[model samples]
Target: MKRICSIYKSPRKREMYLYVDKREALSRVPEGLLSVFGPPQHVFDLLLTPERTLAREDIHKVLANLEQQGYHLQMPPPEEEYIEHLPDELLRRNDPV
Candidate 1:
């Protein structure tokens, strides 16, 4: 199956995204989620298919959630993951002089 999805980024959280059917928009997303998400910023629209590959998310899971729950949330990677990629110089910048 194929679906056209609208992607929105969270203003309050970096790398947090919300996906929903383009036709249905945010109508299906819960209000409580929206409150914490802090008003989604329109990012882009993408055509999703089983064969398509996503950089960080599983395409199949995203499609399944859209089909079953009408929306899918993409959360930021763990803080440790971010720290793992920091350059040694940057990591040492906070060291007490």
Candidate 2:
């Protein structure tokens, strides 16, 4: 099936996004979900298909959720290891007791 979708970003979180039918828009998202998701920022509109590939999500799953629940939530990517970003001296000093 082919669907025209609108994607929205979370103002409060990076790399977080929401996708829904363009015609329905925000009306279909749950209030509790919106409460924590914060206000929606329009990202872009796109056509979704089973064969389409998302940058960080499964196209089939996204489309399935959108079909079943009226929307799809894309969470932020997993954070890198804190130690990987820490200064060498900091990691060395905190290595072991």
Candidate 3:
């Protein structure tokens, strides 16, 4: 049976639900899976799963789609130093348990 998860976004009170297979759920969950609450990107990032590269082209495509649908999104934040790929030596030293 496929277990569906419903995440309630507080302060906003938005409910988002997704149905995924068990294997996918196991691989994608963070240690505190039930407590996670945020946008899709934030949620996935907290889970420490591999993130899809959200490149400039992807942003442009999204803008285009939104405009076509008559939706105007707020300006994107300026790019700051985002560390994605860390050196193995660093991971080894930081490893817990």
Candidate 4:
């Protein structure tokens, strides 16, 4: 299956994103989720296909969510994951110079 998908970033949380069908937009996302997710900032639109690959999301799962629930939520990577990638300078900020 092929679909045009729109991606939105969460203003309240870094690295959190929401994906939905371009045609359906955000209408299908529930108010509860929207409240927690904050107002979505339009990021970009992409044409998705079975053969396509996404940097952070599973393409198949995203498409399935769009088909079934009309939306896909991409939560931020865990805090540990972020710590692991922190620059040495930042990690050493508390250390003596």
Candidate 5:
């Protein structure tokens, strides 16, 4: 199915995005989620199809979520080389898993 999608960025979290059907807008998202998500910043609008490619999330999965849940939340990628940030003392105390 073809759908016109609107993407919204989360003001509280960088790189976090919310995709929803443009026609329905945010109406389908629950109020509780909106509270934690803070205010949504409009990102961009696009026409979605099963074969469309997204920069991060799988387009097929995104489409399925939009159809079933009426919205899809794209979380930010984990910090790169996060282990490097750990204190040397902590790294030395633990065995590599």
Candidate 6:
């Protein structure tokens, strides 16, 4: 087990960055770290929300627990651009004819 040197998270960007020293052995990866995407959605929501305020240690615990639970942590795809519903006339006018 390697001690994490630092964890960087950019909420606006919605990501968690883990940094460990090169010397630490990282052979055993946490399980829940990757499987948090299923039925119990709150965990996944908490992870992705930009308002995360957990203490660093608490965050680490949560992540480690997630990994142990076989939850795989994945950087979800970039959020798709929101498309507003425009009236047909407006869309038509905006379109090049």
Best-fitting candidate, scored by lDDT: 1
TM-score, one value per model: 0.83, 0.85, 0.18, 0.82, 0.84, 0.26
Q: What TM-score quantifies how close candidate 2 is to the native fold?
A: 0.85
Worst 10 residues of 2 by lDDT: 82-91
Global Cα RMSD, each model: 4.5, 3.0, 16.5, 4.5, 4.2, 11.2
Alpha carbon lDDT of each predicted model: 0.95, 0.92, 0.32, 0.94, 0.92, 0.37
Off by over 4 Å in 1: 81-97
Evaluate residue 15 in candidate 6 and report its C-alpha lDDT on the 0 to 100 scale. 51
Per-residue error (Å), model 6, residue 15: 5.0
Any runs in candidate 6 off by more than 4 Å, and if so which?
A: 1-5, 8-25, 30-61, 66-77, 83-97
lDDT of 5 by residue, 1-97 (tens): 8999999999999998999999999999999989988999999999999878889999999999999999999999988775766787586779676
Write the residue-wise lDDT of candidate 6 on 1-97 in tens digits. Answer: 2222323232333454332222332223343432332222221123322234454434455445444642223343455544343566577899988
Query: Could you tell which candidate, 1 or 2, scores higher by TM-score?
Result: 2
lDDT of 2 by residue, 44-79 (tens): 999999988989999999999998999999999887
Among these predicted structures, which one has the highest TM-score? 2
Candidate 2 Cα deviation (angstroms), residue 21: 0.5
Off by over 4 Å in 4: 81-97
Candidate structures ordered by TM-score, highest first: 2, 5, 1, 4, 6, 3
Indicate whether candidate 1 or candidate 5 has the larger lDDT: 1
